[model samples]
Target: MWHPGLVDVVYATVAGALLSTAVVAARAGSPHRTPSRTALVAAVGTLGVSFLVQSPAARGVQNHLVADLGQLTGNGTSLVAAYALRVMVLHVRYDRDTAAARARRWLVALVVAFVAMTVLFLATPTVPGRFTSPDAPAGVVAYYLIFTSYLGATLVSLALLLGRYLDTAGGRWSRLSLHLHRAACVAGLIYLAGRVVALLVGRPRLEGSGQRFNLIELGVTILMPAVVAVLFLLGVLIGRGERWLRHRRAYRRLRPLWEAARAARPHAVLPVTGGGARLRLYRRIIEIQDAQLAAAQVLDAAQRRRIDGAIAGAALTGESAAAVREAALLAAGLAVLRDGRAAGGDGGPVTGAADQEVDLSAAVARLERVSAAWTGSPVVHRLAAPPEPANPR
Candidate 1:
């Protein structure tokens, strides 16, 4: 006779937790809903179901261990099937809504209640050893059929989901999901093939009042669920990792942009060169000009107007406080623009000093030319696509 020992119990418990976690995560990540609030409740029912199969409480009074184990496993098999079906359908109808996200929550709660009640009902059945009467083979058969129906529902739901995904998402992503989707479909097919055969032939008869074929059924049962779990987890992990890595890289790139904007004062555009190079060096000139404009804004109004007019008329050069001050202004602007500081702003330009003229009119002219050139370019418009979670491998 087969026995539900420590190893079997432990494995079932752990598997229950893992499956629950995976299901909850997938649902939570769904666009339509949040995490299932009562995922633990569903897991508890699954654990209880597993435990009953592993350790039938009526082993002493009703040594019908096969019936007990078969019923429990069959029921659980069906429950899991129904869960899969619900997940698939819910995902399709889903919109990240408060109600939709609670899909598993309420259903799981009912399952827990049913499981608890079943445990109580089983504790003291009409017959001492058997949960069902010898005449109840029809009911037992019907129960198995219910589970089979759930599995069928799950298969259809998955097929629908795959079709919808292909129709909506195109290109490489379509190809990728198809890989996992096909694998999962095959796994389901394997399960259906085995279970349908078992249903038609009926559970194998035992010899000598011991489980002769229970072990065979158990082996197939464990194998199918295990394979499905592995494939599903593999797909989920890869998708999640891809999304996270892309987000991390993008954040690292943009981080410096934000930091630089905060750490220094703004300046005007200026350039060290003129002519064609001005267009190429526009970023540098813009940085310089922004700094110059900021410095001017901080100066007294009269001093600012006078210097602005002087620079407008001619360059900053000569040999006196006037020329030196204007050259200093130009130098400070260029320094801040190039090195991202206010160093040369207060010092002097490379070639000109106090009482010298440093022409900036050309820099101003370049800004307009560049602006017009940009404005004259042909405008191209395309539809905006939704952001991708991650780039395809």
Candidate 2:
């Protein structure tokens, strides 16, 4: 008696998008392929299929077909869990023979479970568009056996994944893998638990024309897909998010050097690019390098000596020294340029050696360091300070 609604449409849309993004991500050259990535892609693809089958659009006809597909989707969870376990064991460097033996045993179990689910669903037709209640007693029993067993298996796999993650040492791959595995595990557990609860307690009472519907099943159907989709998408984005923040921070840090150089030679600055952090960072690097080159042409020997003295006086070392030295020199150059312009001296480029290639990465890192210490740097403060009037002569 259930009907397709807005919730089903929304779930389908989101699931479709998630599946598409996963497919794109999975398309690395074959050289980059790994068992873990392959299994994850398969899991996401199979989950998308489940979303499609459960969607309102697929409900009007072919009830048996949809039921079979649903059973198959449970196997997808098993596949992902098996591969995740394999990855974890490999990461921990378990003895190869033992690991392979354990993996083979699990694979056999997974195949048996999949086969059992398929056979059971084929034997009993699902009540079209109604998962909570089936017309026959056999159908009811089949439903519970297939789902609860699958759910129990899934829960075990997820527990293993979580436990391994917690026990293992930390690394970039470990963190990213944990994020992906954790989201998938949490989403699957929630959906599976909800279904089990509904199956146990959502009984129907005979009424005049029909039976009382299970509200729990209805809510679960409407909500689970959306929740899972969002979490999965977030897991995919975690690494990208960290990279973006890093690049953006570096871009902002270089603002002081870029601004000072641009002031002396505005034409050196390039037009800003649009879109994400990576594009902007690339443009920032190019423009900052260009500005430095232009500024070098205008700086005189006397001004250069002053900047060198400021760098020596800064008395910094290591990465910090590299950053502060660049900032102090640039600040001194800006001061000299400003004074020259104020005194009616042309700020034109003076003949100098040809431009050398800039180390964009190092420059950006140093600039970021400079930005971090700008307010506190004595050299910067001195360069920026107004000249003291000569003592009364």
Best by TM-score: 2
| Stretches of candidate 1 exceeding 4 Å from the true structure | 1-10, 13-70, 73-81, 84-88, 94-136, 166-178, 203-219, 262-393
Poorest lDDT segment (10 consecutive residues) of candidate 1:
379-388
Q: Please give each candidate's TM-score.
A: 0.45, 0.53
lDDT of 2 by residue, 1-393 (tens): 355677567757876875786686576333235555565566566566666655666544444556535434534553444444444444344565665676677567666766666676667665553444533345545655665565456556655766676577354744774566576657667776776655554344333434334454555656664676666666666655666677788887767666766776576667664656766776666665565444455455555466557767767667665555555545544555655643321243321122232544554665566666555677767755224335897
Best by lDDT: 2
Clashing pairs in 2: none
lDDT score at residue 346, model 2, on the 0-100 scale: 29
The window of 10 residues in a row where model 2 has the poorest summed lDDT is 348-357
Tell me the RMSD of model 2 versus the true structure: 9.8
lDDT tens digits, residues 1-393, model 1?
Answer: 345464365456545645565465544432223233243234334534443343334233234643354445535644654564465456446664643665557466437634653554455333432433223344444544555555555556666666677666544543464556557657866776675555455433333433544555554455565565555545555555554443344333332322232234432223235332223233344353444455443333343344445444554333332433433343333334444332222222222221122333344333333223222312100100111225679
Evaluate residue 274 in candidate 1 and report its C-alpha lDDT on the 0 to 100 scale.
Answer: 34
